[model samples]
Target: MLDLLKTPVLALQDFCVLCGRALRNIVRRPHYFDDIFLQMDIIGFGSLPIVILTGFFSGAVIGLQMTRALQTYGATGQIGPIVAVTLVRELGPVLSSLLIAGRNASGMASEIGSMKVTEQIDAMRALGTDPIQKLITPRVIATTVTLPMLTIIADFVGLVGGFIVAYYLLNLTAGQYWTPAYQILEWNDIAQGLLKPFVFALVISLVGCFYGIRTTGGTQGVGRATTQAVVVASVWIFILNLFITRIFVNV
Candidate 1:
């Protein structure tokens, strides 16, 4: 019982320490602008296609389902606002973050874990390079910047997908679909939508880097870290979303 309790506490402590170090590195001098840009391109561009598809399909499905449900009450017209709000304020960020956790977080952990197992990170330290500053910082910065942009794209694409379904399947006109959707959204809603992704970006990237830098053993360790990173990040996204949503609701 003691061992079980102690293990989680120690792991939490270690994670907090890693996060502190990464945060400190962000504002320090010698910022790796080139590396940051490289990571941005890799993360943003690499993840675009999947994000688009995920958003599109999610909105499409929501439209199909919600339209039918609303029709029961003869409120089918409200589908636009419902789908828009759901996609923009919730599903957009959540789904995109999940995808990024699976794709980028796993990749980061695997890559850094491989470096650790191969002793390349040690060589970097020996060569007077700070691995956190050089390797982890850039990825963190990139993810923080990229995720919100992706979420925006996802939200827009999702709305389009919703519009497509509403127009074709439900025979709703463009004005009937878009007007309520636009009117129902306020600055607060947009802020809430954008804010979650930024927080999620930090969570996913930092967690990935944390597992990665702590990798042990050999090739097997890399695989383990990669899997753990994705699972942990994905779970955190949902947990964080709930708290963030509550905050938004209360405010």
Candidate 2:
């Protein structure tokens, strides 16, 4: 029983060794640049519209909620600062990471799982090609690079959404929203928020790829990998978020 438990730990350690060799191969063969660029487009550019829409609606709702909550306290003008802090510090990164994990990570697992089912991974190894260099590294780079960019864009759009609705719909002046918004959000708050997505990106890719590589059986295996990838990756993202928040708050 102890050995059965340790088997997973041993397997994970072996995976890291494989990852190091993969990274080396990736560095040596520059042709994988094509895959990297292609993934960035798929992961980054393709995700922009959805992230923006989610950000806009979330921001608008937050503004509306904050306005109502503050009105009860007769401190309605504080809505801007509260909205800004929430958007910049918490909502923006967390929401964006969860969305990306769901969107990209599950798809990644399914795609790779299908390849495994088809014996393409074995074929690549037989042909003297490093599958990780060809496949996993590009995903890792693209997701890590793209998510922070997405987070920043989401922050800006979300804040804009809040500001527009607050100033126009709620009858708060433009100055009322923008000024207090500025005052409440420190640079470090933004930085700490931004720092989180990289960890999430890594978690998503690792979990997705881990399941992808382990995929077996048949159609059922592919389906299982896809579902597990999203579920596990999202849970990991939430857990990581808690730790990150604690670190940021404490330090």
Candidate 3:
């Protein structure tokens, strides 16, 4: 029992230490701007098509379903605001973050885990390079910067999708569909919408790096780390979303 508890406790401690170090390196000298931009291109632009596709369909589906529900009370005109609020406040960020975690988290884990198993990380240390600063910090910064931007794009695309459904199916004109959607958003909603993605970006990037750095068992370990990174990042996204929503709910 003591042994079982020890592993998780130690892993948690190591993860915390890695997070602290990586965050501290953010403002340090020898900034790897090139690597950071490469990661942003990989994580941000590479994930764009899927994010937009899913965002549109998700909002369209919600519009379809809500149209039915709202029609029960002859409130079909309210579909715009409903879809807008749901996509902006929750679905847009959550879905986009999940997609990003699945794509980039696995990539980070595999890339870094391969480096670990191949002793490349050791080689970097031998050459007087800080692996955390050179590799992990760049990823953290890229994810942090790009995730909120992606979430914003997702929210906009989703609103457009919802508008299509509303216009065609519900006979809502552009004004009817867009006006309330525009008016219903507040500073609080916008704040939380952006904030959730920022938090998720940190979790996804750090979890991937942590698992990658700790990988063992050679090739098998790299695969395991990749899988764990995606799963853990995705799980933490949901868990953190709940906590953030709870905090914002009362505010």
Candidate 4:
């Protein structure tokens, strides 16, 4: 039993250590503004189209499904509020983070893992360069900055999709849909919408870096790290979302 627990425990310890180091590097200089912006372009802009597409369809699907149930109670007009709240409070952040985890988390792991296996990281160490500062911190900062923005975009696009469905299928005027949707969102909901992605961004970047920096076994290890990074980041995103949502709901 102790043996069984050891690997996971050690991994958790390592992950926490890596996270601490990466975060600490943010305050310490050699701030790689160039690398940060480059990663932002890669992870942020690169992921944009999918985020928008996913947000739109998810909102449309929710709108379509809500129509029948809502009509039964003559609550069709409530669709806008329902969609808005769901997207803003839950789906938008979760889905956007998951998409990024699948996309950029894997990429981060693969890139860093390749560098690791190739001894490039070791060479950097020999040259007095901190790999965490150069490689991990930039990705962390970029993801933290971009994920919230992406989540916001996702939420807005999702609302638009819901509006389209409501306008056509439910015969809700733009005013009817937009007003309730706009009014129903509280500060708490907005906070949750923004906060979840920020937290998730940390998880995605850290997990990817952790798996990456620890990679061994050459090419096979790189593959393994990439897969683990995506899986772990995605799982943590959902887990954290639950806790975050619970906190907001109770607050």
Q: Give the number of the best model, judged by TM-score.
A: 3
Give the per-residue Cα lDDT of candidate 2 at 156.
Answer: 80
Sort all candidates by TM-score, best to worst: 3, 4, 1, 2
| Cα TM-score of candidate 4 | 0.98
Tens digit per residue, CA lDDT, model 2, 1-251: 99888978986896687557555665676458889899999999999999999888888889888877788888878878887788778888889989999999988899989999999999988998777888888888899899999988888888888988788877889898889888888877988778998888878877787788889988999999999989998998888888888887965
TM-score: model 2 vs. ground truth: 0.92
Candidate 1 residue-wise lDDT, 1-251, digit = tens = 99889988999999998889888999997799999999999899999999999999999899998987899999888878998899889999999999999999999999999999999999999998899999999999999999999999999899999999999988999999999999999887899899999999999999999999999999999999999999999999999999999988975
The TM-score of predicted model 1 comes to 0.97
On the 0 to 100 scale, the lDDT of residue 191 in model 3 is 91
TM-score of each: 0.97, 0.92, 0.99, 0.98
Better-scoring candidate (TM-score), 1 or 3: 3
Residue-by-residue lDDT tens digits, candidate 3, 6-60: 9999999999999999999999988999999999999999999999998999999
Pick the winner on TM-score between candidates 3 and 4: 3
Backbone clash tally (model 1) = 0
| Evaluation by TM-score, superior candidate among 1 and 4 | 4
